[model samples]
Target chain A: MNNPASKRKPYQRELPVDWWLKHAFYTKYMIREGTSIAITIYSCILAWGLLRLSQGPEAWQGWLDALQHPIAILFHIIALGLALYHTVTWFDLAPKAADIWLKGKKLDDKFIVIGHYAGFVLASLAALIIITL
Target chain B: MSHTDSTKLKRSHEPVFWGLFGAGGMLTAFLTPVMILITGILVPLAIISPEALSYERVHGFATSWYGAAILLVLIALPLWHTLHRIFHGLHDIGVKRGRDWQQVICYGAAFAVSVFVFTLLLQML
Candidate 1:
C-alpha cells in the first residue's frame, strides 16, 4: 500500500494564474461566468425580501425602502447589464444545441436566434405589463 | 485489478443537475434582465410607482398557488445555473483543491436556498 504504482507524480505544466486574462475570448468567458456572482446575490436579495415579507408589512416596506438606496440601485444596474450579457451569450449558443427539421430541411440557426430574441422581448413586455397592472 | 466486475456502469446524477442548469439558463437569459430593470431600477427610481410593488399587492400575489410557483421557479431555478457555473468557474480561476467538496458546497448552497424559498412560500400560503 505504501508503494502504489499510480502514486508517482506526473510532469504537469503549471498554468499561469491569469491565463484567462491573456485573451479577449477567455476574458469574455470569465466575465460571463462572473455574472453568476451578481445573479446569486440578486437572488439572495429577493430571498431576503421574501423573508421580510413573511414578517409583515413594516418589514416588507423596510425592504422596499432599502432598495431605493444608491448602492442598491448601482448594484442592480450592474446586475442588469450582466444579465443582458448572459442573455446574449445564452441565445448565441441556443441554436447550436437545438435541432429542428422541417419538410426535409433543417431550420437555419439565424431563425432560431431571432426567435429567441422575439420571445425575450415578448416575455419582458408581459412581465412589465403584469407588474404594473 | 480484477476483471470480474459488474457489466453495468455506475449512474451519475449529472443529467438532473444539467437539466436544471439548462432550464435556469433559459429563464435567466429571457427574463432576468427585465426583472432587474423592474425591481431594482424602475420601481426604486420611482419611474414606476412604489405602490406597484407595495407589500399589500406583493403579499396578495404570494398567497396564490400560481404566484408561489412562479416565485419559487424564479428565485430557486437560477441558483442551479449560477452555482453550476460558479463550481466550474472555481476551476477556471485555479482553486484546485477539494473538487468534490467544492461541488458539494456549490450545489448544496443552491439546494439550501431552494428549500428556504420553498418553505417560505409554503408558509405564506
Candidate 2:
C-alpha cells in the first residue's frame, strides 16, 4: 500500500523572476517600492556627510564639493526621480493602508490622498523656511 | 489537511518589523523629495546657491540637538525601510532557500546601522 503522503499530488506554480512585469498594476507597485533603493543611497551619503562634518570644516567642504561633481550630479538626478515616485506612490496608497471611518461611514479615498499632499506641502514650506533662516 | 496546514504555520512576529517599516516609509515619503529638491536639484543647478549648504553652516546644524535628531531619523529609519523592502523583494523574486537567514541578514543590517547612527548622532550632540 502506498503511503498517504505519496498518494497526494502537490501543486507547484513557479513564481516568475519578473513577476511584476506580468501586469500593469504590479509593475507600478514594484517601481514605486523599488525607489527605496535611491532613498537608501541618499541615507548612506548623508551618513558620510555627517562623518566629514565631524572631521571639521575642510573635510566637510570636501564632501560638499564632491556633490558638485558630474557623477554626483547624475546620481542626484536619479535620486530625485526615485524620490518623486516614492512620494506620489505613498500619497496614492495611503488610503488603502489607513482605514479611516467617520460617522459610521467609510471616508472617501480622495480626501486621504489630498490630505497627504496638503500636509506634504505644508511640511515642505516649513522645511524651506527653516533652511533659509 | 487541517493538521498539515496548522503545522506549516509557525507564528511570525512580523508586526514589530512592519511597524518600523511603516514609520520609515512614511517619513521618507514626505521629507526625502524636498531634500532632493534643495540639495540635489536646486543647489546643483545653481538655482539655489551652492553656498546654501556650506560646510560651516551644515556642520553647525548637525551639532545642534534638533539637527542631530532630524539627521538620525533621516539617516537611520529609511535604511530599515529599504532593507525590509529588499528582504521581501528577494522573497517576491522567489528566493526559496534560507528565508530565516535572509530575514536576519536584512533586518540585522538595519539594526546595526541604526545603532551606529544613534551613537554617531549622540557624539555630534
Candidate 3:
C-alpha cells in the first residue's frame, strides 16, 4: 500500500455547518450580507411595478393598493430594517474598497464614510425636490 | 517573480463581480432606506400622498428616457449586488454543492430581470 503511486495525502476536512455560528463577527458579517434579501424583494416589487405600468392605470393602481395592504406593509417594514442594516454595513465597508491617495498620503477612512453620507444627503434632497415639484 | 512570470499568472474574474457589488453597495447605502421610507412609511402614513407616486405620473416618468435610465440603474445594480452576496454567501455557509451553478442562478436571475425591466420599459415608450 506504500507504493509511490499509492502515496495518500491526508483528507482535508470540509468546513463545519456551524462555522459562522462559532464566531460573533462571522455571524454579524453573514447577517449584513444576507440583508440583500430585502434588496432583492424591493427590486422584484419595482420590476413588477414596471410591468404594471405597461398594462394601464388600473393595473398600476392595483399594484399600489397591494403595497398598501397589511401584509405588504408588514413585509416592507421588515425590508426597511434589512435595508437599514445593509446601508450601515455598506457604509462601514466602503473605505476598504476605495483607495484614494491625496497628496502622497492615504486618505482617511472617516473622510470616505463622511463623504458617502454627505453625498447621500445631497442626492436624497435633490430627489425629494424633484419629486415634490 | 519576473514580469513575464507575473504576466502568465491569470487573475481571478472576481474584481468585475466585486466592482458591481461595490457600486451596488454604494447605491444601496444611499437609496434603499430612503425608498423604503418613501414607499413604506410616507405613502402609507399619507404624509406623502399616494398621488406623488401614482400610476400616471410614474408611468410618465418611465416613458421619458432619463426616467427610464434612473429606474434601470436603481433596480439593476442592487440586484447584481444582492446576487453577488448570495453567491458568495453560499460558500461562506458551507454549501458544498456546485458554486458555478449557484453563480449562474444568482446573477443570471438578476440579469434576466434587468432585461425584462428594460424591454417592458422600452415598450411603454
Q: Which candidate's DockQ is highest? A: 1
**What digit string (tens of lDDT, one per residue) describes model 3 on residues B90-113?**
888777577788888998998999
CAPRI grade, predicted model 3: medium
lDDT of 1 by residue, A29-75 (tens): 99999999999999999999999999999999999999999999999
Order the candidates by TM-score, highest first.
1, 3, 2
* Candidate 3 C-alpha lDDT tens digits along A38-67: 789889998988898789999888888888
Enumerate residue pairs that collide in model 2.
none
Write down the C-alpha DockQ for each prediction: 0.89, 0.60, 0.70
| Model 2 per-residue lDDT tens digits across residues A22-127 | 9999998888768877888888887777787887889887887788788888998999889888889888889999899999999999999999999999988887
Using lDDT as the measure, the top candidate is 1
Q: Which residue window of length 10 is worst by lDDT in model 1 chain B?
A: B1-10
lDDT of each: 0.95, 0.83, 0.84
- Residues B1-125 of candidate 1: C-alpha lDDT, one tens digit per residue: 44446765678999999999999999999999999999999999999998999988999999899999999999999999999999999999888888899999999999999999999999999
What is the TM-score of chain A, computed separately for every candidate?
A: 0.93, 0.83, 0.82
Name the TM-score of chain A in model 2.
0.83
